[model samples]
Target chain A: MSFHLGGDKRASLAEAAARVGDGALVALGGGLCARLPMALVREMVRQGRRDLHLVGSAHSIDVDLLIAAGAVGVCEESYVGFEQDLGLAPAFRRAARDGSVEVRESCCATVLAQLRAAEAGVPFLPVRGIKGTDVEGLHPEYARMTCPFTGEELVVVPPLRPDVALLHAPLGDAHGNLHLDQPFVLDERFAHASVAVVATVDRIVPTAELVGAGVVVPGHLVAAVAEVPYGAHPSSCYPGYAYDRPHLAAYLAAATAGGTALDEYLARYVHVDEDTYAKDVDPERLAAWSGSTRAWQELFR
Target chain B: MSWALDAGHAAQRSWTLDEAFVVALARTIRDTEAVFHGFASPCAQVAMHVAKRTHAPDCLLIEGATYAVDPVPVFVPPTGNDLALHRDAVYRMRFEEFFDAACRGAVDRMFLSGGQIDGYGSTNVTAIGGMPHPKIKLGGGGGGGNISASIGALTVWTSRHRAGRTLVADLDFLTDLGHRTREGSRAELGYTGGGPQWLVTELGAFDFDGDGHARLRALWPDVDVDDVAAATGFELRVALDGADGLLDPPSPAELAAVRAVDPLGVRRSEFAEVELARTPGLSGVAR
Candidate 1:
């Protein structure tokens, strides 16, 4: 009942996102400074889904890219990475200037409200804790009547119920149970808030082997599973892996340098195909490039 | 060169003239103090002023807006999001990937303020009027005030007018439930940090008692207990000995420090004026 699939197999990222429907709330999972599914997100952007609502805590290159491409209509709460990480993507800046996106504070609250709403089987949940601040005006939906006892004004936030949650896990089983050793704040909530959840993992192991591996989002919440090796590249999976800083630096350079520069760069490298991009860059060479002065300087330039 | 605390004539003084409060606030988080600040907060501006001037020359000021620490130059990208300042510093990754460090308690301290906080320290930043059907609609509360109560030590402050805005009793919406009503529930839920430690306001200071009620800790000099009582929408228990009242006014030395740090008088003057306009009666103080 929790799973649904479109007819296409090996569909593009845009096709996957299309299945989510319009005005759908989407939740993303990754590291504070990890790589996100940008290639997939690019596919979503190419599809030009304007009715999508994005909610997340921290900023990622993928989110930045989406916002740049005009894919996100509303952002509940999120932070933008430093410009160097952003590459040449100016979409976030343009959106803020145009008042297309409303930035609020606190990712946990946004995720939690959705989780509570889903758990309570309600359309939205009322929350407190932000009052007499600018956040009240930014998120007008949360402000409420003065307390009967206290006579003070309150801000109420509605719960977030996403139609689909797209997450990447380090390991999983065929049945979709996930194993993420990292300590995350809102992944559990994202799992609960979604009508269906899709998880992409690096490896597929037996369900019995995951018995004591410290599961964050349980298997039941996960709808479908896909196995993709080194899926969390750019974004580290913690104990299992680390971020590919060189590839990320190169990506940052191309993304932040301007659209023309990005096009030229991606054409020479990333855009041809995932396999071509993967084969073109030598892992050993990337590994040899230390996350040092040269790397940072190159990224900015 | 001299520090003088004058209780009787405190209100007559300007932020430029009064230095004690600035000095105390600055000195509090000088060395190795992991302080957290909220967005668009004037108090945070003052804290930054203090931190840069007094103590930790290399202080790690972690901003919610951005993650690049010191040595990272502050560049205000055109977007107005301070996080953009560090965008160049962020490595590419999936979104929501950063919570690993945050959940493991990488953050040390946080600054927070609330609307309609109750006796239980529960804050509501939700809708006003009513739940399903409300007379007045409000912006959705963000973050649910969880970060404020979850951090190691939370310094809560507000600059709102006391009369019609503040709460006298329990809140209509619950943003953050400060100290849980029952003792065992918090630990049972896997949260290990203490609740809010301090509540500060333009009028006075408050702290939660062992029994889980806010107790008045201090009042601003030149502010009468009646003024505070009238301004507060709720009935509050005053200190028995009146020891919590402002006895020693803010000293000139403190004022000098504030002036020296904020040479343009940004925190005390224009900023205060902007905040005062939002809350009535404070306009006189601003002028």
Candidate 2:
């Protein structure tokens, strides 16, 4: 691989954040409480980046936190609610309620279909489910096509190519060979779907350590790899840590209470780097992080 | 004794609305059949697990978020994607792979809930008000559109079956394409699966009639037929004459199994917190 395309892609979280420009469309990896780049997002908030576009990143705290920090302009969402217990995400709710964030609603399936189209280097892809749905009528960007042979109606979704992908992996080499601990079916597709992929990993191991069968995001696809251990805190990272329930609960509370409470949350936790934040927070709670639900595994066994 | 079978003979009258609804949904699970549950489906997860433990012991499970069927954990993580479900996963596949399987005719059943479902069974999870931008934006379909088109039997469940917000006369936007404008729409799309087979709500159970409209098939106890009709925004097609076709409450065996799977009671969270407080020493008999 040429040095320009695939060389030492190692950098600090701030450097990785710098690579993303204003109004760049970004793909978020491992959404819904797993492997979100929390530190990179926090660093982006610190850097005061604006007008960033988020795609396929809805329905999780990852996007909620960024939107709360006022870093997003446009968002293409499949789903955008918090868990049933957590109610709606506060920032996202306020943003959507006020129409500040230019919101485009796509089904969860459509996002994957769009990403798959991008991965395959196709201009547009036809989906069987889009017809006769509100998702069809709302977006003029989506058009209906009659199958030439069958004369069947189908929705044609245009290709979605993100400028960058914000991803978190369990381990990676200094050369940027990222290995995700879970199945993570969408990571590779998102990486190929984007012009650049930046990842925050828990550990940077030798190239040899990333061997064997697993979900591997190869060095060539990754533009930068920053070591932000526990980067996925408040969200689970396999074999590294589980989701911080208390932290998540705190965030939910703050988000629910809104106003100065949210600002305080940003100041207390997000404003600080991982180290000082970790020091301020309880280590015992952080220790709750683990690879899998061992309790569930043992129960089934 | 394990809650799995320690359950005693509790009369059907003792069942909560949610419990009765779950049992009603579970009865549809045929033995030795593959059923797929999608995102934000905690109630259906509990129902599927109960179905496996009771009547449909051999019924297979394929969860959308975790992609694990018959998850060992009785409790679904509040996060729609429960990692516990990933333990000993049978066949983990993405939504795209599953939808592709449906396109090729693989998935037999799917359970989905939405913000709004119309009389025709077309689900609208895309927008609450008129399109372009909705008054209330909802979580969009993960793959419900393809699943409803492909899955032979799509069981649509909702906790609160209110009018306007839920059981609408017509959808503002269509999230899952159930039966197009007319009956032949699926055929036009080359979809093989029967669209939106069953609809489960708080008050009653429903299915599409020969005319491709939501026909109330059964009602839970204490639910008035007229009340259900009034709750539905559209004119509903009442299939059953009376309590004649109404399903009995879940058996003590099924209830026990449901309890074992949902020890935390996440499924009944739609009710206020006061619902959790018992009258006096019922330990945990109430939903």
Among these predictions, the greatest lDDT belongs to 2
Error of 2 at B160 (Å): 0.2
RMSD of each: 12.7, 4.7
Q: Worst lDDT window (10 residues) for model 2 chain B?
A: B275-284
Model 2 C-alpha lDDT per residue in residues A1-301, reported as the tens digit of each score: 1212757999999899899998889888886777778888888888998988888833578888888888999877676666665666667767776788877766666777788888887888887676655566556888878879887767889888888888899888887888885447467778878888899998888777776534378888888999987887777775655566667878988886889999999999988888887677653344432323445333222
lDDT of 1 by residue, B1-287 (tens): 11232445454254421233344344445466555554334344455545554555666655443333442323222111222234344332111332233333554556555546655455554434423333332333334344543456555555553544655475554545466433233333334445666565566666767765666766654455676677676557666233242223334554444554444333343123544333222223432
| Candidate 2 CAPRI assessment class | acceptable
Worst 10 residues of 1 chain A by lDDT: A80-89
CA lDDT, candidate 1, residue B238: 66
| Deviation in Å, model 1, residue A187 alpha carbon | 1.2
TM-score of 2: 0.89
Give the per-residue lDDT digits (tens) of candidate 2, residues B1-287.
11122235435335555665566778777886788876666788778887878888887777656665555763566666646556566556654566577655677778877778877778877567755556776656766765677677788777768543689887777778676553346666577778777888876788877767888877654466887877889787887743333256556787777777776666776543433232211223344
Each candidate: chain B TM-score: 0.67, 0.84
